[model samples]
Target: MSAVTDNLGLFFGGYLRSLSICLWALVGSLVLGVLVAACRVSPVPPLRAFGAFWVTTFRNTPLSVVLFFCAFGLPELGINRSFFFFGVLGLVLYTSAFVCEAVRSGINSVSAGQAEAARSIGLNFSQGLRYVVLPQALRTVVPPLGSVIIAMFKNSAVVGAFGVGGDLWSTGQTLTSARGLETLPVFVGIAFFYLMITLPAGAILQIVERKVAIAR
Candidate 1:
């Protein structure tokens, strides 16, 4: 208990690192996920096939393997960068697969007539998706997407294990191993910090779900 209290600043720094990783991963995944979703729904056969391949390859691959590849594999190919960069990249790549699927499901839920209506108004495919289909699809998938983001918050812990220093998980390790603090208390503090992020997110998502339901 004293260890946790004395090292509050250390633990807080770690929490902020984890938060940064989550935020960066979330933005990257959402952008890439939307593009991939567009590809999956594209009229172009090659685009659809590419999108399918991406989803299959990443979605089936374990997150740890993906991180391993990014952490150890990329530098061999001359893509050297910080472990933090690689960690975030791996998270983005892995999470984007799930995000793609979620958005694709939402796109499927949208009425086909919506696309036809957009086309009838002289809108191109890109314009139709941007102005019409995606807007509605996004609203429909809000809950699922929220779940994905929440999962991402938990998954960010893995990044610290892969040499991205100064994250909550690694901080716990430092306390337990280096500082010789009691493991249980250190991890209890770590769990508390994670819950701090996820619980409020879940609450906000529920509120958003309610408002969306009312709007519908």
Candidate 2:
């Protein structure tokens, strides 16, 4: 307790850095995921196949393996700076697979009539997905998307294991070692810090989900 109280600045700084990593990772994953989901549902056969392959490949891989490749393996191939960016990339690459699946499921949930109606009005596949289907699909996907985000928040801890600095997991390790092993207060404080982000986020998404809920 005394250790944590004395080192408030360190904890806060680490948490802030971790939050930044998660934020950027989340944004990138969502964007990539949507594009992948679009590919999975593409009217063109090749695109759909490629998208399915992408999801299967990443989803089958471990996050640690992906991080290792980004942080270490890529440099051998002259892909530099991905070491520092690995934490961000790790979350994005792994999470996007799940995100794509969630969005695709949402797309499936939409009634076939909607697409047919759009087609009747001359709205082709791409156009309908862009202007009509994705919007409705997003509403259905929010709850699952929220869950994915929360999982990403937790997974951000793995970044620290890869030596990315100023992350909460690394900070916790440093703090515990610097102090004695009896750092209950430190863990309690950390849990509080995590809940600070997750609880509010969950509640906000729940509200957004309610608002966006389809009438069906």
Best by lDDT: 1
lDDT of 2 at 170: 73
Q: Where does model 2 exceed 4 Å of error?
A: 178-183, 214-216
Q: Which stretches of candidate 1 lie over 4 Å from their true place?
A: none
TM-score of each: 0.98, 0.92
Candidate 2 versus the native: TM-score?
Answer: 0.92
- Please give, for residues 48-94, the per-residue lDDT of candidate 2 as tens digits: 99999999999999999999888988788987784448779888999
Winner by TM-score: 1
Prediction RMSDs, each to the true structure: 0.9, 1.8
TM-score for predicted model 1 compared with the true structure: 0.98
**Candidate 1 local Cα displacement, residue 3, angstroms:** 2.1
